[model samples]
Target: MKTILNALAEPNRLQIVELLRDGPLTVGDITDKLRMNQPQVSKHLRVLNQSGVVEVQPIANRRYYKLRPEPFKELDTWVDSYKHLWNERFDRLEDYLHKVKRKEVDDE
Candidate 1:
């Protein structure tokens, strides 16, 4: 998971992942869409592939890049584990706000 996060931490790699979210694309396609040179796009793709965030398929001489679902599913599960903590914090904040509002009304 750290590796996946590190890979996605790079802005260019994150953009590549966003592009792949729509569908698989070749290096050329990404380069064109991002207005970046081929070598730069390829480098980002390599990092994404090494981190298991994306997979490459060689079809006829072109490499197609697409997202790997497993990493994202793992990330989702990790985030979901913290949901209850966030909910509790939000509930406490709500209760405090209500108490403050009531105090203000009484003072008025």
Candidate 2:
């Protein structure tokens, strides 16, 4: 997970991942969409591959990159843990607001 986070921390790498989210893309396709030079794109792709954030498939002569499910699943699970806490806090705040509204109406 640390490796995944580190790889995604780069602006270029994050854009690459966003491009891949639509579907698998060749390095050329990514380069065209991002308007980045081939070598720079390739370097980011290599780091993403090493971090297990993206997987490469060689189809004929072209290499296609796509997101790996496991790392993203782990990330989702980690985020869900925090999601529950935030939901609880929001729920409590809503309740307090409702009570205040009721108190205002009672005073009127």
Candidate 3:
């Protein structure tokens, strides 16, 4: 998970992941879409692949890159663990707001 996060932390790698979200693409396709040179795109792709965020499939001479679902699913599960904490805080905030509104009405 740390590796995955580190890979995605890079802006260029994140963009590559976003591009792959639509579908698999070759290095050339990513380079053209991002207006980056082939070497730069390839460097980002290598990091993504090493971090297990993306997988490469060699079709003849060209390699197609696509996102792997496992890392994302793991990340989702980790983030979901904090959902209850967020909801509890929001609920308390709502209660406080209501009290403030009531106090304002009484003062008026």
Candidate 4:
């Protein structure tokens, strides 16, 4: 979890993960989409791979990158557990706004 979280902390790495959500991409494809140099892209990929958030597959000399998925699911589960806190706060705010509006309408 820490590894995945740390990997995702980097903005470029997050974009790379989002890109890999669709399908595997070669280094060239990633570089083109990100408009970054090969070395920089490769460095991001290395961190992602080390964290197990992404995997690399080589066909001939071209290597393709894909998201591992499980790490994201784990992160999602962790986030899901705390989501009700947001839901509760939003519900309270909504109720308050409704009452305030109703009071204003009645006064008017």
Candidate 5:
């Protein structure tokens, strides 16, 4: 989705998502791990949450953030649609390179 892509477009938010991949983390933990201030980390987390890339679980006082799989799975599916195109192009390129190498060897 556009919203999910836009949310991941920001470097900080992308990094936050990568961090969440390992497991759930509190805002403070994210801030400390990223070496960023609380407000900045919180803002990135808010964007990720809004885009449905991450979900939060509130345990009494602290909120822990974790990846919600679906958005990323959707992204993977979209990318897969173009996977064969890349493979075809790479195969063509490889064939051309092999021909060039054979020609050079013959010349030598």
Candidate 6:
């Protein structure tokens, strides 16, 4: 969880992480997607690499990045646990509204 939290700490890093959701991208591809320079992209990638949120592989002359997914899987599981709480609350509210509507019709 340390790596997951740290990886998501920065806005640029988060943007870069989200962009890599589809698949691996070269440095140039990620930079072009973000409208940033190569150096800036590398900086974010470095942080992600250190955090172990992403993996980098050198192919030919260029470096490519891919999402590690493990860290994000931890995050997803954490967030998913609270899903039912919101749904239950919304369901209650909907039932209450329908009851109120029926009461109004009866009074009319």
Candidate achieving the largest TM-score: 1
* Alpha-carbon runs more than 4 Å astray in model 6: 1-11
lDDT of 1 by residue, 1-108 (tens): 899999999999999999999999999999999999999999999999999999999999999999999999999999999999999999999999999999999999
lDDT of 6 by residue, 12-108 (tens): 9999988999889998999898999989989989989988899998999988899997887888988888899989999999999999999999999
The reply for model 5, stretches above 4 Å from the true place, is none
TM-score, model 5 to reference: 0.87
- The collision pairs in model 1 are none
List residue ranges in candidate 2 displaced over 4 A. Answer: none
**Which consecutive 10 residues in model 1 have the weakest lDDT in total?**
10-19
Question: Deviation in angstroms for 57 in model 1?
Answer: 0.6
| Model 2 lDDT-worst window of ten | 1-10
Q: Candidate 1 vs candidate 6: which has greater TM-score?
A: 1
lDDT of 2 at 33: 95
Clashes of 4: 0
The whole-model lDDT of each prediction reads 0.96, 0.96, 0.95, 0.94, 0.95, 0.90
Cα RMSD for candidates in order: 0.8, 1.7, 0.8, 1.9, 1.6, 2.5
Q: What's each prediction's TM-score?
A: 0.96, 0.85, 0.96, 0.81, 0.87, 0.76
Model with the higher TM-score, candidate 2 or 4: 2
Q: lDDT per residue, candidate 2, 1-108, as tens digits? A: 789999999999999999999999999999999999999999999999999999999999999999999999999999998998999999999999999999999999
Per model, state how many residue pairs clash: 0, 0, 0, 0, 0, 0
Candidate 6: lDDT over CA atoms? 0.90
How many residue pairs clash in model 6? 0
Better of 1 and 2 by TM-score: 1
Evaluate model 6: give its TM-score.
0.76
Clash list (residue pairs), candidate 3: none
